[model samples]
Target chain A: MGDLFTDTIVISVLAATIRIATPLILAALGELIAERAGILNLGVEGTMLMAAFAAFIGAYATGSTLMALLLAVLAGMAMSFIMVFMAATLKVEQVVTGLALNLLAAGMSLYLYKAFFAVEGQAMPTVAVMPVAPIPFLSEIPYIGPILFTQKVLTYVALLMVPVVWFFLYRTKYGLEIRCLGENPKAIDTKGMSVSLRQYGAVMAGGALCGLAGAFVTIGSSARFVPDITNGRGWLALVIVIAANWRPSGILIAALVFAFLDALQLQIQGIGVQMPYQIFLALPYVLAIVLMVLKSRRGRSEEPARLGVPYFRGER
Target chain B: MGLRLEPRLAPSARWQAVSVAVALLAALAVSALLLESAGTDVGVAFAAILDGAFGGLRTTAKTLAKATPMILTGLAITVAFRAKVWNIGAEGQLFAGAMASYWLYTLTGPALGMALLPLLFAAGFVGGGLYGGLAGWLRSAFRVNEVLTTVMLNYVILYLLSFLLVGPWRDQSSFYQQSERIDRAAWLPDLWAPGKLHLGFLVAILAAVAIHVVMNRSWFGYEVKAVGLNARAARFKGINVERTAVAVMVLSGGLAGLAGMIQVFGVNHRLESDISLGFGFTGIIIAVLAMLRPGWVVFVAILFGGFENGGIKMQVATGAPSAIVSAIEAITLLFFLTAAALTRFRIVWRST
Candidate 1:
């Protein structure tokens, strides 16, 4: 057991966990906002996918990492706007609309990439990644230095988002209005606030974050986008949102834990273990299932009270 | 004041039809604009799309061939959605069916006669049904959310298929990690001359009609719909909500499984990822576009089939990605969803 603790593989696994968790942390933070607004935006997967591709394209074209990141976030925000219109204004079933948007994003992005780039492979042009902004003296520190300082800009943003989100939700009036709209639109309506606008704003915010998270895969870490590059990270983000009981700070830790499991799976597969690599491949999903089961037993207390139910003006 | 809930009166069929048509037109217009913005000629693209969808006899055959699995999967989605089951595991279920049928076909090829067809179908059905049933069971027993469970199962099944293909069930002789070829006797007969159109097309139409009868005429179908519209009210009416949910799921899964069996027997004659072609999720689009009506499912399935057929041609002609069709389908779903939501309730403005 001590050997396992001291293993180089274990150390590398911890490093990889941070890398993997970056995207999840960012995406989950976004989802946390959307769900907190009583909007179930299932299209996070698709939005991330499109953003990932767009980020790669942008980075590859301009050879500038910042531009790629900005463009990706904009694209994500645009997609979320569509969801907001459907759910907030039109009052459709959030689940169906979200799923449709995801499918649309998946199909459109893949098609567009193939049409424009004319290539299909695991990697793309290697653009300059976001520079690791290490603190002046922190770089000299031991274990925490590499983990905390020597990472992409998105990593710090994702980490910072937890507190920022917590502050935005707990310390601000707008955040309170968003929560009120989610929990009870009627109450918000009675207060003379535009519930639809607040809900839309929250969902759009989530979309922007999801896009940035996806761009992290393209511009921050990998510097490339493969087909389906988002690869269920969006879903994992959804799981993280639930695991955190929709709390922003909790989302950060849950994202890290889920990312750790995913990173652990990769490390286990790499160690040349005798077990079938298939089992390792199955690990993340297995963990998701376990988490879901545990969540189901915890009762409906944790879920947003009015999740997935559309609010109509009058006739309730 | 006390709250009182009332049933929403059904909208006129003419209005529903109009809404669907308007949604389709909106989808096309938006996609056309997108194409134009992307520097493509919209007129040429539209013409090309049409030609690709139904250009010649060959195109029609291709469209029908593609429509086969879509029809079954659409039914799968429709049945499940009608009962409010939300079984998003059709893709995985289809994979399961193909694997099961392929496993049986490879094992019982020589010994099994024409009887192999029914057995293979059964294998596919059982595989899909069991997979779907697992989600339903979890939902009914533990009150687990079916949406998340089904979605998670999809990933599990995908990994399972990939693992099996790359490992134990791999055909060692082949360059690709694929299963051995199934027996020719189990292959579905072709009804078209000099084209890929097969018995599956006719089966799809027949199945659609059969579903229409079931949904409109059968007591079970009525129960499923009632349970779907309102579970609490359905239970109050003495309906077995859990049982109906499970039964609908099983039937839905069986339909999806049959889709897989058809692909293996009718088109691919083997177990592979191409058999799915994302028809499982595409079926969801079709069901939504059709508004979960069986008769309408056929029409929507055919429309999607045409788009898919044309999409391949578009890819060849314009170098557009094949996934463009998925994008269009997704847009249609989004449009329909918004349209349906707006039409469901009137949001009239009133001066305070």
Candidate 2:
């Protein structure tokens, strides 16, 4: 009674929650933009993996966290370039193309890791993990301050992105055009706007955000890159996008929910819970399926009509 | 207007053959570049791959042994993708099969004598089929995306397997989280006594042949194709689209589960995590590169099997990472898909 649910533990768990949610929020918002633009980039996981690996390698080589972040973003964009090129230009099956990117990343990352760094089989190279940037006055506040203010810079950016993404999706003209591309690409094509061009833009931008998400997984949180470091976090973000119903605010809630489970799992394991840790490890994915079932019950979902269907001008 | 794409009424066989060849050459060229960049001699690596694949009878047997599980997973993918049902949980389904078969063997191994092996295989099939059925039901009933659900299920089953291995099934003798070595009587008989080729390879070949016939000649096959081509039209034509989708998943999952069970009974002789080294994902590449044809699946799987076996040898000799093979396989699929798109369309210069 004095240990598990104590005030100190609660605060630490909540703080961990925010830190874990950072990448999910970034990736989910990125996926949201792609879904809105009528491109279902199932390659988000692959895009994130490539970026995470790129960020890790960059950090190790250049010894600059900023350069690592930039490298990750560029890697994310490069992967999305292939995704958009295949989906928008070549019109290959979107699902297959996305899977190809995933497999490609899985193989290429492991190959490069082994060839470049792991060849020695000596000490695992470490990077300077992002220093936590606490807000000046806000960080001094009580429980709330530690939970929210004391976080990496990317964590704050992830939170701020929710509103920024909301504004861009709902308020701006280009956002309107992008949304129109998802619901009715023919409408944009008829009005003399390039549907594919906007799709490329939306997907590439979303990819950049996923890059940042990937960067956070490495340079932001951990000091060393492990094989399959992102694990299923990338997939979890896809689930969050669906649970969020493709909305930004909903995405933040859904991400925090999943991240909370992760944080709680970490805390419970730390306290030496009686149950096997694998059960806790498996909870988020189980909940993801449950959340999807709940999502399906809610009618009038905002899923884009043309999502996953490639647009060809003049085709009904 | 400069250039336009005009759909070919029916793509010529020659164009397809040429495109595939070009895709292969380009993919191998990239692999060569990767090897050279890694400080490995390109010519030696390529020669090593070919020699390791088919240098002698012993090497060829190893390649076939390596290809066995992939062939099954490849067939699993072919069955599901044929009906446009993306069941990406072959990895999880494989584990479920292994666990189920192992559980059944431990429970009834003494009572069931000769019937043990067949029953274990059946248990594996049922186990995998049911796991796949769950995803199918979720997709059909709840409108959950099969891709996402299947992917999640893969991770869930892995954790589940990890829990079982550590808790209930941990072998006391060894420190690893794995089961006791299976009974010697339960081992699959070797197809070639002198070689490493086992009866499991025969089963994979048989599965491939069965899948080819079912996909091409059966009425259920027609229903699956109809549903995949156009679900709405298939429904209008009196086909139960949802049920077909579920059935497709069951059949696909059964094949993958069988692969996992065979890996346990035939190859490793124990249940372990390393049973699947991204075989499910690699199966996707194999199925696609084969153009989703069962006959081609066997050929492509063997080719990849050679790369895997060769890459390991190259690593020993040249210190290059064995991961180059997987990278090469993925690059091939991407290039092939691009070439397929190019061949499917004929470019026309338009002047308006």
Candidate 3:
């Protein structure tokens, strides 16, 4: 009986791990695409915030999870479009552009929330969180089923994207061209293909994926929207991409590591451990710095040659 | 191509100034449109903002008071950015300074009287400097990117502050996550009776002047510039790039820390989580639009400071949320960056 109890606890923690990894996976994969295309879009945090706000608004207004998801994806894409436009067309400094987008989102989202959401003499309005979908026959298994198969639809999509993204990056022609843009954009320019166009495509696609990640933050789990609710998760995804060495499978493992830490913290807090919860909250950020230091020390890296540099057709 | 850009050998100063003016005007136009669309009267909002920002000596003093922290933070950014060392952790460093100075004040229990003021400022500078120095050390020792490390530190310190606020430092009489007020003896001397302006404004200016001297008239400033222009070239020229990076961050973080210390003693009179209203982040916009020039930072910070006060008044006069100021700040930044980029090239028409 004791063994069974321990087994159940372990399975529960692992299950929570899969569930929490959803947003990180989606956002990091999106970041990977953008980085592969030579645009270091550090605006992922802002994009996620905008998408999360949009999803909350959509879900609250229409009471449709699908509609919320669509709105979120659109919001994400719109935010990223700004990043691509400023970075590609004007060749503005990507770092400053990214910072501007994040600040814009912070102000706009709060302004909209205050202006539209709050009602007089009422508690904060909330929408119904999405119901979990347990797969037939698959969710009945003892350990693995509860841990992996019985999650929200977005979790499955996030996991499935690992392979899909891998295939797109390695076996596909467009993926090859996108990678080439980062490595040597002049090659694509010499071939008469528009470097700017390819960057636009890659970044927008990444933004759409980020939209999904953001949607999961509020519509999928929480009943109401909170300002800066994504918190540092979006930034964590950026760290995961670097720690993953810019590979789909590596991202999967790195994301799981972060998710597991979060899941374990939740469980620890649930059991009412005798420690400050703030310490648990601070772990991932602390670990992110450690991971980056370690990654920098290691050999055989896969960093893009010209990751943050803007391309010029005539430049040497 | 219908139109193309040709690089300007020397971008005309007159055109740069004109374009920047047009960009600010355009940002205002966009803000007006946004307000109109949001069911707010553009006229009332702008007028209210102007009145709140500069209508009288009191409001004008308040605006300058508001700009005090920003000037320091803006200079902090300008100093580091001039060396191309990105220190995104100024927000965190600011908090570190506040917490450290407060802790010192509590320990000393105002026994030192007004003499404690300089000690608190020193503690703040050291607190923020050490926090910033960690990221610098990481960059120099581990080749870790300062951007990520500094950002992570920002989040980490907030949690630390949160813990201290709720656990050890919690104000028992009050219900918020903040510490007890500092001794009145340590409060900044009031500059004017019209508004609650304090000595912090003068300090910010003095800092700017000191920074102007350090950055332009000193050999260390030249080393920083060389490293920013090209690290490899600087190293080849016998400059220690890594050490310079650490020194730049220390200076940047120290100034940001001073901003935090001043906010507590001069404005808030107590250290709380909300003491900093994203002043550190806004410094980036100010520094960038100022073209990383310290002289321009003060003027830009004052303009933004006016926006802050005006935003509150506008929110009261109209139903619009005061966050519009932040949005406008960002819009101005985007437009200014574009205008700066545009100034580098002249439009050329091509025959197809």
Q: What are the models' TM-scores?
A: 0.93, 0.98, 0.97
- lDDT tens readout by residue for model 2, A223-286: 8887778898889998999899889999999999999999999998888879999999989999
Q: Rank the candidates by TM-score, best first.
A: 2, 3, 1
- Checking candidate 3 for backbone clashes, the offending pairs are none
Ranking by lDDT: 3, 2, 1
Residue A241 shift from truth in candidate 3, angstroms: 0.7
What interface RMSD, in Å and to 1 decimal, does model 3 have?
0.9
Tell me the spans in candidate 1 whose CA falls farther than 4 Å from its real position: A1-7, A119-126, B1-18, B37-41, B344-352
Lowest lDDT 10-residue stretch of candidate 3 chain B: B1-10
Arranged by DockQ with the best first, the candidates are 2, 3, 1
If you assessed candidate 1 against the hidden native complex, which CAPRI class would it receive? medium
TM-score of predicted structure 2: 0.98
Instruction: Identify the leading candidate in terms of lDDT.
Output: 3
Compared with the true structure, all predictions reach lDDT values of: 0.81, 0.90, 0.91
Better of 1 and 3 by lDDT: 3
Clashing pairs in 1: none
Residue-by-residue lDDT tens digits, candidate 3, B66-132: 9998998899889888888988888998998888888888788877877888898898888889888
DockQ values per model: 0.66, 0.87, 0.79
